[model samples]
Target: MTRAAIVGIGQTEFSKASGRSELQLAAEAVLAALDDAGLTAADVDGLITFTLDGSDEVGVTRCLGIPDLKYTSRIPQGGAASVASIFHAMSAVMAGVCDVVVVWRAMNERSQFRFGQPIARGNIPAGGGSSFMEWCLPFGAQSPASWEALTAQAYMHRYGATNEDFGLVSVLLRKHAATNPQAWFYGKPITLEDHQASRWIVAPSLRLLDCCQESDGGVAVVIAREDRARDLKQTPVTIHGAVTTLPFNHEIISDYYHGHDLAQLPMAQRVAARLKDLTGMSPPDTQVAMIYDNFTPQILMQLEAYGYCGHGEAKDYIRDGNLELDGSSPLSPNGGHIGEGYIHGMNLITEGVRQARGTAANQVANVKTVFLASGVAGAIIGAG
Candidate 1:
C-alpha cells in the first residue's frame, strides 16, 4: 500500500484567551502548516478535523480562499479524534482520494467555553447523543473530571496507587514543559509538593494540577504521499500505522461500565494491539511516547495499556525514571497536555511530528520513531 507522511506542522500560541474566533484560529494554523510544507492553500485538496470543532469546511475554505477540495471529513469521540484524524487523512492520501491533506483542530475552549465545567452548567447538552452522559449527568458525574474520577478511584483501589503517584506524572511533565518555550507552563515548573497542595478536583484521585489545561489554540498538520513528502521543505515523518478501536460497552471518558476491569483501559489496549499488528512495533520500540494526558491517571492507565509496562505497574514504571528525557520511554518530551496547552489532543500529534523531525523543543536524542495515543486511537510516525 502507498504510505503517507506528515510533512509540516503548525500551531497558534498556547493561551488562556486566543482573543479570536475558532475560524480565525483554524485559518491561521492551516496557512502556517501550508507554509511550513512549502505549499499553499491551492495545494490542499483534503481536510480533516474533529466533529466537535466549531469551524466548518466552508468557513475554512472561505477564509483561506481554497479553490477546490476533493475530500473532507470529521472524526468523533472527542479528543480521541486527534490521532484518528490523521488516520483518515492518511487513508485518503494513500488511496489516491486526495493529496496534500490538512488535519486541524481549533478551539476557544478556555475563553469561549470550558470543558471542565459541569455539563448542566455549560453549553454542552445533556444527551448530546451520548447514552453514557445521559446516565452520568443525573448522578453528579457531570464533567469530564468527574467522569474520569470514577475510573481513577477504581484503578487506585486495584493497584494501591495513590494521589502522590499520579502527582509524579504531573511533576515530570511540568519539568519538561518548563523548558518548552511554546508550552503554556513554560518556565513554571512545579514540585510534587506543589501538586499535592493543589486543591482536589475529584477527591482522593484527581487534583487541580492533575488535569490538563483548558487551552485556547489551534493545531494543524500537512500530509501527503511519502514520495511527495520527501520533496517538501521539512523531513518527512512517515505514518507507519494508525488505528482506532472501540470495544464493546466502552463510553467516552466515562468508561467504567465496560463489564471488565476498570483498572485497565480496554480501548487503549485495543488501539495498541492494532498499532502493533499494523506496524510490527510496540511502545518499547518507539523512542518517544506521546500518550494522551487529559488527566494524570489516564497517563498511568495508558502507560500500561500501550505495553510500556505490565498491567497495574505504571506507577513503578514511572518511579523508575522511565519517563525522564534519557530514560527508556521518555514520554511526552513536549510536556504533553498536562503541562502543554491542550487543543484537545492535536497538540500531542504535532509534538510527535516534531520529535520525528528531530526539531522538538525538548527533543529526545536520536528519536527515530514517535508513538501517539489518545485512548481509543493510536499512530506510529517514523523519520523518513
Candidate 2:
C-alpha cells in the first residue's frame, strides 16, 4: 500500500481542565491541526478517535463546522490506542478510503473524571470481579503504580537491579522537563537523591515521582497521502511503520504469572523488530525516541525491547547517562509523561513531531526520525 504521512499537529495547553466540554476540546484541537496543515474544516474527509472517547465522531464534526465527511472510525484499548488513532487514520488515507484524516483525543480525565481513583465510587457493575477492573483493584492494585510494582520487583530479582536503577530514569526525565517551558515541571529538576527520598506509591518499583500526572487536555494530528503531503506548507513526516501488539493474556497492569520474567515483554520486542524491518531503521539511525512512559519501568523495558540494550542491561545502560539529551539515546525531550502532562502518550507523540521539526525546547541536533511508543488503544506509531 502507498504510505501516509503527518503534515500538521496541534494541542491545547495541558492542565487539569479548562471547563470546556469534551466536544469543544475535540473541535479546538482538530481545527488547530487543520490550520497548521494549511487546510480548513472542509478539507477533512475523515475523523478518528478512541472508543472510550466521550465525544462521538458526528458530535465533533458538527462542533468544528465541518461540512462533510467520507470516513470515520474508532480504536480501543484505553491509552494504548492513542498512536493507533494515527495508524488507523493513515491507513485509510493510504488505501483511498479518505484524503484528509483527523486523528484526535480529548478528555477531562483529571478535572471531572479521575481514572486513577477506585471505580467503586460510581457503583460497580454486576458482571463482577473478573473485569479488567476486578483484576487489580480488588487486590490492592488500585492504581498503575501498584500494578507496575509487581513487574519492577520481579525485574530486580532476576537482574539484581536496584531502586537506584529505576531512580535514574526519574532523574533524567525531570532534568529534561526543567528545560522544557511547556512541561508542567518546568524549571523543576529532581536529583537522584530527591527521587530516592520521594514517597513510595507501590514500593520497590514505583515512587510518587515515577508515575505520570493525570492531565486534562486534547491533541490532534493531520494525516494525508505521502504524495499529497508535499503540497502542504509544513515538512511532511512519513509514517514509516505502525503496529500494535497484545501480549498473551494481557491484564491491565501486571499479569505476573504470564509475565513473571520482567525482562520478557516479547510482544513489544516482536513489534519493535518488525517496525525496524519495515522502515529499514536500526536503533542507531534514529535521532530521538518518544517512548510512552506511563511508568518509569516501562521506559526501561521499551529500550531493551527495541534492541537498544540486551535483556537486563537497561540498568547499566541508563546509569551510564546514555539517555541524556546529548548522550547516545535521548529518551524523552518533552519531559515524557513524568515531567510533561500525561495525555496517554499523545504528548510524547507531539514531542516526537517537535523533535523532527527542530523546535523542541530541548531539541536534539539533526533529528531525522522518531519512534513513538504510545500506551493508548493498543496502537503504536513510527513516523519520520
Candidate that would win on TM-score: 1
Index of the highest-lDDT prediction: 1
Q: lDDT of each model, Cα atoms only?
A: 0.91, 0.77
Per-residue alpha-carbon lDDT of candidate 2 for residues 1-384, written as tens digits (9 for 90 to 100)? 778888888888888876888778878888888888888888889998876678898898888888889998877666667777777887798889888899888888899788566554222523211245555666767666776778778777888878878888888898999999888899999998998898888777778787888888888889998888889978888777777766676653554645446556766676677667676775545778777788788877778877788988998998887888988878888898889887776778778887887878999987878777663222233334
For model 2, where is the 10-residue window of minimal lDDT?
121-130
TM-score of each: 0.97, 0.92
| Predicted candidate 1 versus true structure: per-residue lDDT over 1-384, tens digit per residue | 779999889899989999999999999999999999998899899999887899999999999899999999988888999998989999999999988999999999999998788886333544322667767877888889998999999999999999999999999999999999999999999999999999989898999999999999999999999888888899899999998887887887878778999999888888888888998998789999998899999999999988899988999999999999999989898899988899989999999998888888998999989998899999999987
TM-score of 1: 0.97
Which regions of candidate 1 are displaced past 4 Å? 121-129
TM-score of 2: 0.92
lDDT of candidate 1? Answer: 0.91
